[model samples]
Target: MNRFATLFSASALSTIAFGADSYAAMPHPGTEPEQQLETTITRLSPSAYNVVLIESLRDDHSEPPFANVTPQSHEARLVQASVIANPALSRKLQAQNVELDNIVGAETAADGSVTFYLR
Candidate 1:
């Protein structure tokens, strides 16, 4: 029937729209950045940098600040906190000697790395 055809079309479009995205659907991404001590921050320009948080860091449940965020967003926020609290990113900042403060955005890779853009 026409309704069935409409449903099939909608389903196909939905699949195509979402199928291309590679981020994992992590329902119970445990913990915050506590155990995740490793992170990388690379300067993209004078005022911007990128932070990379390895997959293991994102394998835990979300914390308070990041509690309501989706898994991908959770990773981004987690990395920011992890690096600041964990020391390596702070060291990188000290070495680079720049004050980076704002979190612009974040992206997840299928290969287990989440990169955050900061300004």
Candidate 2:
């Protein structure tokens, strides 16, 4: 009886571990955008980021080249709440006739929120 119980427990443990690994292997639908953005942002210096704002888009998704960037590798979160929260940045960009496409800065948290940066 003890041998049977041990076998059952071991099987249960193996099943749980396998299940956790499978879940981890699957791509997270929510984290995708932030992960991509983080890859792009890390490729730039502060000056480069500013210049990027003035850059044009070939299509709605023709963002800067960040082909091999890794998210969560940066020193900080890539979006700044203050920038998104500020009326001034919006106004400045608007004055330049650049409609705020997104705000992929380096200081925002990822909580599965639809941030302006991820737009």
Q: Estimated TM-score per prediction?
A: 0.29, 0.30
Error of 1 at 69 (Å): 13
Off by over 4 Å in 1: 1-79
Model 1, residue 54: distance off in Å is 21
Best by TM-score: 2
Please, what is the whole-model Cα lDDT of each candidate in the order they appear?
0.47, 0.45
Q: Single out the weakest 10-residue window by summed lDDT for candidate 1.
A: 37-46
- Which tens-of-lDDT digit does each residue in 5-119 have in candidate 1? 9999999998887875634443336432333323323322222334533333456675323323443465445545654663554566556653434443344444445455444
The per-prediction tally of clashing pairs is 6, 8
Residue lDDT tens for model 2, 16-47: 99999999888777555555555444332322
TM-score of 2: 0.30
Q: After superposition, how far is residue 33 of candidate 1 from its true place, in Å?
A: 12
